[model samples]
Target: MIPRLVATDLDGTLLRSDGTVSPRTRDVLTALETRGVPVVFVTGRPMRWVDELHDDVGGHGLAICSNGAIVYEVADRAVRRALPLDRAIVLEVAARLRAALPGTAFALERTHGFAREDSYRSRHVEPVGTPHGTLEEILDDTVVKVLALHDEMDGDAYWRAVDRLVGDLVDVTWSSTWALVEMSAHGVTKASTLALLCAELGITSAEVVAFGDMTNDIAMLQWAGTSYAMADAHPAAQAAATHRAPGHDADGVAVVLTELFDLP
Candidate 1:
């Protein structure tokens, strides 16, 4: 069946290796929009980051940011809903991580922005082109996610330590080299957030198709009607998907969408 909605992950799923959408992929997505099929970007990125692509990809539909912690409607430029982090839990987890991995860089993601300690500026090198902000100002608002960024640190080891220490209090996952760890409230995830959006759009889980490529995307990949893992996906992500596409650099999403919808 042709899905009524196509929900996709951004960084390593839909976006190419260069972090840009290919012309062919963009054309296909635009065609999907023309057909009135909602294309929702379900990503670990913050709402402000989503704005960077609003004029391009988001012109077609809403976005699910912070891995489902918040949903934003592009047309109205308003937050449709939000699942904020528990303030106490966030503080507790942050304290524990600081003690366990002293000198490790960390950031907090709020419904509208992201926060980082002043020390993070000099010690950590962000991914090329990604933005940064101050933690003090950001924490004054409702937080939706927390991230740990460190180089030369064993990501799996850190994740294990975090799980052992605060796993019961938050949801933890990673999208890239263990250099980063993303945390959300105990029950908030991309899957749950997408389900809510499906209801709002009067669609059903059976009519949704999703694509992803990392541990953070597992839940949503498994929840879709037809889930696809990128060819270069992590083992956990591949195992959770119903099928596999080529790879992000290969425009895998567009390849799968065209075949699934039988589009020319």
Candidate 2:
């Protein structure tokens, strides 16, 4: 069936391995929008990281960001809505996680940008974020998501461990393969926010087609009526999706869109 809406994750899914969108994918999305089928980018990236992607969705499209803590409008270059973790909950979760996992670094994804603990060293310099500061100083205000970075553990192991500790307390997820964990307020996820948006648009999950390539996209893949897991997708994501597409480097999502919509 032709989907009324198209939802896709960014990293490792719609983007090439180098983290750039291919011209073909961009054009296909723009064409879909022209045809009255809205394309939504659902990702774990924060608002700061998404500012440059305004032209990706024909310069004006909605994005579900920060694993569902934010809804950004590309053209307007504004956050239409922000769902931040309660400061009290953030404090409680941080304390419990620190005690459970020694040497873990903490960071906050604020509404405007990012901040982190002084000792925290990200795998790469974040495109946008303040220099390191004390955890308390970084989190002085409410934040959309909390980051838990570990030095010695692998991504899968550390995430599972965090799940064992605070899975019930907050929404835990990760998009990249690095030893990083992201937490949101409980019950928040790409799927939840997308569902709300779909409701507002008078669309149903069955009329939506979603795509992703990581563990963070599992809930969304399962929520859509038809889901595409990129070829290099995490095992859980592949298991959750209704179908599989080529790797992002191969323009897997574009291949599927072409088939589904008869795009050139």
lDDT of 1: 0.82
Measured on C-alpha atoms, candidate 2 has an lDDT of 0.88
lDDT (10s digit) by residue, model 2, range 1-264: 799999999989988978888989888887787788888899998876777666666363788999999988877878888888887788888888889898899988888677889888877677553757777777755599999999988989999999889988899997767789999999999999999999999999999999999999999999999999999899999999999999999999999999999987
Q: Which candidate achieves the best lDDT against the true structure?
A: 2
Q: List the residue pairs that clash in candidate 2.
A: none
| Candidate 1 per-residue lDDT over residues 126-207, each given as its tens digit | 4454445554444644888888776667877777677787788998877757667888889889999999889978999889
Candidate lDDT (C-alpha), each: 0.82, 0.88
